[model samples]
Target: MAESKDLLQVLWSGADVLRGKMDANEYKTYLLGLIFYKYLSDSYLAKVYDLLNDETPDDLQEAQKQYEEVMKTEDAKDLLQELRESMHYTLEPDMTYVSILNDAKGNSFNREKLQAAFNRIQESDELFNGLFADVDLYSNRLGTGDQKQSATIAEVIKVLDGADLIHAKGDVLGNAYEYLIGQFASETGKKAGEFYTPHGPAQILCRIAMTGQENKRGLQVYDPCMGSGSLMLSCRNYSTEPDYIKYYGQELMPSTYNLARMNMFLHRVHPENQHLRNGDTLDADWPTDEETEFDVVTMNPPYSAKWSAAEGFKQDERFMDYGGKLAPKSKADYAFLLHGFYHLKQTGTMAIVLPHGVLFRGAAEGTIRETLLKNGSIYAVIGLPANMFYNTSIPTCIVVLKKHREGRDVLFIDASNLYEKEKKQNVMNEEHIDKVLELYNNRKSVDKLAYLASYEDIKANDFNLNIPRYVDTSEEEDEVDIKALTNSIKETNKAIKESNTALVDMLNNLTFSSSETETAINEFIEILKEV
Candidate 1:
């Protein structure tokens, strides 16, 4: 923990120097861009030394001849292996982190050298063509003055040079990036909440989505509103073969879209297996004509937002099957849900976090809810505590949908009370999260926390997926003992009368107010009896 703290301190110093001089949002790009450059440079350095030591002729000509021979064999010159052979690329004479830093000596303080180095890095690898596309060093958000910009760049480079990012693992960097996103969410409040889910609540949702799917391999997973790709990455963490988990998702925000893509690459999810698209998922533009499908679909889309549900979509395959009555344009909660469900494979499962209103709201949303339950697409509803999101205080729920059902009953988990309050935020610790996952796996009825709602019961309620309608989390009013309450109130009234009488007698002996004191005693006894 102390080492982690030290690492953060090292990173923080760079951020602190740029605090008032740079916009908080723009600062992340500079820091993250440098970290990625360091990552690639370290990867390059690690392999070059290995090539120099490999068994070959000490003579440069002989070694060159042997290296060429080695490259011609079947599966001989893989790009990754070749990259390890030398710290070289199709770039101008001097273009690397070391070169950029060395150039930053006296004149490099203004840092045109660093920008040139970044250009070469981006141009060298087609695989990383658009990787740093969003990191704009020339953006005005860094500040208007050259002094401020130069100072910020110098501070950033100094921090990067001081830190040993080469020795750090990708997970460590990814974790730090996630931490920064969380901090931004808190600092930016409502705007940040638009693209972020609190890490703790996101973790609980991820734990639930990932349960019972551990041993699976080559599992296809997706998120409709994949902000920062946190939920999808969490699913990867739960996989027995994490490397085999293929990620797919969509985001409407361009900045968040970039972050999600970077997150996939940062975690080392092969670029080919990642299918993140930047667009409204309800009208996904992925090459779905290929019949691509996912086995796990998890998301926490913006609570309730509007969409066009354009008339052309009436003939589209996804909404066409729902009798052409699109989910109203005012609330597209069910629209996103339907999109995910449509993309889910026959054997797949989907878990979505939504405002609880979806369960009981009337009109178009209610109609869609009825259709899903009646068709047996929904499998469970887990109620979460209020304020689980960063800026919103509204209570929410997770709706679990499945293309295939193992049983006829729907599980209802009333977990609204299973959270600890930390400062002003409600958090679900590992125990609370584990309990929800445990109950979900058992699929059995627990007295209060969980109950299996039969299909008939759900039908009787007109297919309202409201958890309280099924699970009964209403505390039972402490059993309401009328007999005991009456007995206790009567005894309390008699005791009050005796105490008042003693006070009245003492007043009379002092010749104060005998009649008035008696009346006051009677009024006090009557009020006590009413209780």
Candidate 2:
């Protein structure tokens, strides 16, 4: 644990090397790209050292030297082939991060060499085609001219080279990477939503999605708007056979798509098990091949963003089943939900974070909510605290859906008031999350905290799923005692009247040198008596 902390400190300090040169959002590409490069190079060399045990020396420098020497021989061809098949990418002897760091120390570093290394990695496999596109080493944002750019890149490389990622455990390195991503998200503020979900809500979504699948084998989990793959990764924490769980996701942003891929690799998720794509999730349906439906689906899409919502979309299979009415072009919240729900298995569960407006809004959304409620697809609705997310402070809710559920009741939990206030955002502690999960699993009404509303009950409210309508979380006003309050006021007034009389007597007894002063004192006493 101490070693992991040290590694995280070293990696985080690399930001200082480029703090003023670029924003955290921009510099994140450079920093994360280099960390990924180091991880790849380290893993490659470590594997080679393990394979060439008798022939290679044990010392780090000596092992690297021997590995390079071996790579120059004809034997390197077979080793490269095996590595490519196993790791999905390969690095040349000179393309390793250690080699670049050694060159930088010798003042022989150039941005072109680093650029070429990135190009080589991209060309190595389809998964890595555009992996390094966001990291522009020669960009003026790093520095003004070629010399400055080269120097700045070299300095960042030096700072990262100090961290021993190869010696660290996979979870250690992955945790540090996640830590840096979170730090950058904090610095990035609202834009953080583009690629990251705050840990609190992410865990809640995961728990809700993985409720009954804890002991199941070969469980498949997916996220449609998989920002940085944090929510999908969180599901693995609860899985009994995490290694067997297949992960699938689609991200809209290219940079974030690359981050998700790197995040998966850093966490030691097998390349074959990870099926992440870079594209708009709602622009078109995905996974065109086999395995359309997933066992568990989770999403935290952009709240109420506009979409084409073209008339042609009514024919799309995902939307065609929802009657002729489509989600409004102005708000595509229901579009994202339907897309995810369409891909959920009959026995699967889905948990999505959405704006509160979807609950009671009439028009097209109301029709969709009514359809879902009648089918018993909406399982549980959990109201999270406001400001729990980095993007917007507006309170959001997580609607848990289970297809073909036997129960016709929908559980509503009002957890909006159950959060710890921070300096900037409200946070849901473990107790808060566990309390919600406990109520959800129990599936019982808990007075003001939770309510199990039947389909008949929801229909009575015209299919409005507003949480407050079901779970009354309103605090009771204190009861008042009018008679006691009136008596207290009368007693206080009597005390004031007695004090005024005493003051008047004192004023009358005092002798005043001037008639004006005596008149003023008498007038003051009269005013007190009137009060």
Candidate 3:
């Protein structure tokens, strides 16, 4: 744990080098993108060193030295081809990050060489095509002139060069990357919603959706709104076959989409298993042709975002099942839910985070709600504490659904009270998450914390899935003390009477200093007697 914190310190220090140069929303692209670039360069060198000497080197510089020596040999062409086949990309010795850092340390760095390395990585495979488009070394935000801009970038590289990403064990490096993303989210505030989800909710969402399918081989996962692919990537933690998990996702923003792509590679996901699209999830349906359904689906879409809600959508397969009704234009919460649900396999579990309004909203949303309830689609609703998100402080709920179920029974866990205030945000620590999961897995009612409502319970409320209707989170008022209360009031009245009598005596005994004071005292004494 201490080492992980140290790695995070080293990684975050790079952001400090560019803190004043641009906002986090912009600088995060440069810092994270460059960190990924260095990872790739160092990884390439390690692979080359292993292939050449049959043993990994102690450090990146050692690998770089051996690679430089090998490039002069006649067998270099064969070595490069083999590296391309195995790694799907090849970095020349001169273009490696270690080589570029050496140049920067010597005050002879060329920014163009770093840019060329980025371009080479992008060109080597379709998985990396246009990967670094968001990293603009020439952007004026870095500095005013060519020299200053290059120096600024060099400073960041020099800071990041200190972190030995290649030697970091387990998921330390990956967790460090996630830590940087979370820090950036903290800095960007509302805009952070575009590319990040707070870790607690993301963890619970994935865990609940993956409850029974943890050990399933080749588990297929999808997220309609895969912000930075964090939630989807979390499925690995709960899986016995972590590497066999395949990820499918879509995002509207190209830059965020680019971020998700980088996130996948940083986690070492295979290119073949990643099916991500850079497109609006609701504007159109994706993955329609190849493997449209998945074992687990999770999403934290923009809460109550507006969509077209066009008349044409009534016939769209994703929304058509809901009595030919579409979610309202002003609020697309239901729309996002249906899109993710439509892609869930029959045995799959789907979970989504949205505002509380969805459970009780009327009009078109009501129709969709009724259809979903009658179909036994919604499995459980977990109420999270308010202010758990970076963008919106409004409390949200995770609606866990299943396509085919034994009954229409729904488990309502009112975890709204299970959080601690951390600075300006509310956070759900492991204890809180474990409590909610305990209730969910138990599937039984707890007095005020959780309730398992039957289909009749839901129908009696007119199909309203409002949690408060089932689980009463309202605290039971403390019992009153009538006898003690009355005695206290009598004692208080006696005290006031004695005190007022003393006040009147003091006023009457006062030596009047002026005519005005004498008249005021006399009038007050007479008024006190009348009262």
Which candidate's lDDT is highest? 3
Q: Tell me the TM-score of model 3.
A: 0.98
Regions of model 1 farther than 4 Å from truth: 1-5, 53-81, 84-94, 103-107, 124-130, 139-144, 289-291, 478-531
Q: Residues 68-88, candidate 1: write the lDDT tens digits.
A: 454466644463356633433
Instruction: Compute the lDDT for candidate 1.
Output: 0.71
lDDT of 3 by residue, 189-225 (tens): 9999978889889889989999999999999999989
| Candidate 2 lDDT over residue span 1-531, tens digit each | 899989988898888898988789999988999889877877777777777784433445555786799988999999888778876777777877778888999999977777787888888888788888898887999888988889999998989877887678777888788889988988888989888888788888999899889988989888889988888988988998988889989999889999999999898898779899988888888987968999999999999999999989999998886657788999999999999999999989999999999999999888888888888899999999999888899999999998898967899998998899988788888998899889988989998899999888998999999999999877899999999999999999999999888988888899999999989998898898788
Better of 2 and 3 by lDDT: 3
Error of 1 at 303 (Å): 1.5
The best candidate by TM-score is: 3
Question: Against the hidden true structure, what lDDT does model 3 obtain?
Answer: 0.91
Task: Give Cα-based local distance difference scores for all models.
Answer: 0.71, 0.87, 0.91
Candidate 2 to truth, TM: 0.94
